[model samples]
Target: MFKQLFETGIGVIAIAMLSWILIWMTRQARFLKAEITDSIKNALGEDNRADWGIFSLIFIAVFWEGLETALFIVAKFQEGWTPVLGAIAGLGVAVIIGMLLFKWSIRINLNQFFQVMGVFLLLIVSGLVISVLRHLDAAAIAFSHISSSTDLCGIGKNSCILRPQIWDFSASLADRQFLGILLKTIFGYTQKLYLIQAVGYLLFWTIVGSLYFRSLSQSTQLKPANKFN
Candidate 1:
């Protein structure tokens, strides 16, 4: 019971951090390079320690990503080795891609790359919103049992006070199946869903998606002006 509660708390924190980063990255897309250059210059001051400044910038960026990855892994630890393996594979792929883009000096459309990745990540995070709510609901039920409070879960075998069950697709496409699991992992698909979970999922997509798309469009509009200048 306590374990589930702890995991749920971690999920909340992970999702919150991911959502903030997604929105922030989108909004700062245009100014991020300049900001980083400015930060490095300020950090080095008149010393003009280009090497140290570059190293410091790299270290901080890597550390920030590493911290987020750790939190994400911990939040999804109960899902078995799949998430862990995926994370490792993703890191490997990212490293290779970084080498190709930078070390090899391969030309690629970074704007398109980031835009696509942003949308993909947004979908995944939105799904996590639902998953987190489910975890919270399960934890609440377990807590009720420990406290011997029947009011917390209402009636029925699967009844949850968090929100009434909206749909159950287990019979047609169970989350345990291959396709179902794929969707569940990638898109946050579930065999069963609750009112609050649905609302939370859609709301996240609506709010975050709006901000991201708006920022993207604004950046696109500014590109021509930047080119002209």
Candidate 2:
């Protein structure tokens, strides 16, 4: 009960909050006073002795993401270090990436990063649908297990894993169903995958990942040009 709220609630609130903030930022942009704009511009201008525009961007992004995650932890967990820890870990990764970006001035391969993260999110979505089915089955008073022998299993190698037994979350300390729910919310997963979802996931990952990595590979091979008047 508590676990579900902490896990799922965090996600819902964070997304909503982010959306709200973006809308507010857009609306407030025109109202920003020229004095304020000039001050910020001075701080961010490329001519500044301390190049802060990049840092400012990274700081705001990480801060808001961290802040939202923290609120989620408090609201859903009712009070716990889990969300804080999660935010910290995420921040750590971002910091490492930021340092690299600053030290090397080379543009990061965002395409590849998006492809990797996209594939991971897709798998989570696929898993979530299947997990929800299991949750419903568990809540059922007289659930009957179906046989893999059903036509859905497929005639040959493509056959589904025969009436897949819903995952038993009991083995782990926290009920896996509950944990799976948490993962589905946080990481995303599906227990019983539909034929189409599986194919689509595979196709998207293959196409996107391939293209992104190919771009990276090509970029790496490009020779450095001498910049002179």
Candidate 3:
């Protein structure tokens, strides 16, 4: 219990700090919503107005994301300290990288960094969609009462739609073991996924990937047109 609480505290603090860093970087990028900017800038001189407007936008965005991330870290930390430690290490590395980028005058291509991170974040969100579906399926099974004679393989409403096994890779990577745990933490991997989980995972990635690529294509087209103009 103490470990869990400690992990949660660490998670919360790390998320908050990261949120501040992200907000700062986003402001440096000059990426503020037009309405938010205009509304908050009404009282100030034009030059100072833009800065405060961006700050306000960053504050709101960071607050909301930080709260959400805190809740998420709390939930995930229950799995074990490995994830918590991993998150802490990741946060530390990010801080060091940020210091090097800013304080040490290290150069990095911001556009490329954002592009790569955008794709990675999208993949993580897709994995989350799968994880949520699997958790729901697990909950449904707990509520379901299975008789001794009942077939375990049946699907749909009349039978166990949730627990109809799709595949088991326990022989290779048992879910609770080190490698399995790391994979699961990073990619939402599972050795004993069910039919519903598989279907949901495929569907989520398909939809999100299509939308993502479409947006990228549109942006690419717009850039060339803008350049020509």
lDDT scores of the candidates, listed in order: 0.82, 0.49, 0.61
Give the higher-TM-score candidate: 1 or 2: 1
Which candidate, 1 or 2, has the higher lDDT?
Answer: 1
Clashing residue pairs found in predicted model 3: none
For model 1 the TM-score comes to 0.67
Clashes of each: 0, 13, 0
TM-score, one value per model:
0.67, 0.39, 0.55
Model 1 Cα lDDT, one tens digit per residue, 130-187: 7778787888777777676456775454746456788899999999998999999988
Using lDDT as the yardstick, the better of models 2 and 3 is 3
**Residue 191 lDDT, candidate 1, scale 0-100:** 93
Candidate 2 lDDT by residue in tens digits, 1-229: 3343344455445534543443343334334444676776777664665456658778999899878877776675655777667767876898888888898786755534654664464445444434433333332212122334344334333223323333433445332576656765664454444454445445644654454455445543552432420
Q: Score residue 20 of candidate 3 by CA lDDT.
A: 44
TM-score: model 2 vs. ground truth? 0.39
User: Model 2: residues >4 Å from true position, as ranges?
Assistant: 1-70, 73-78, 138-229
lDDT, residue 211, candidate 3: 57
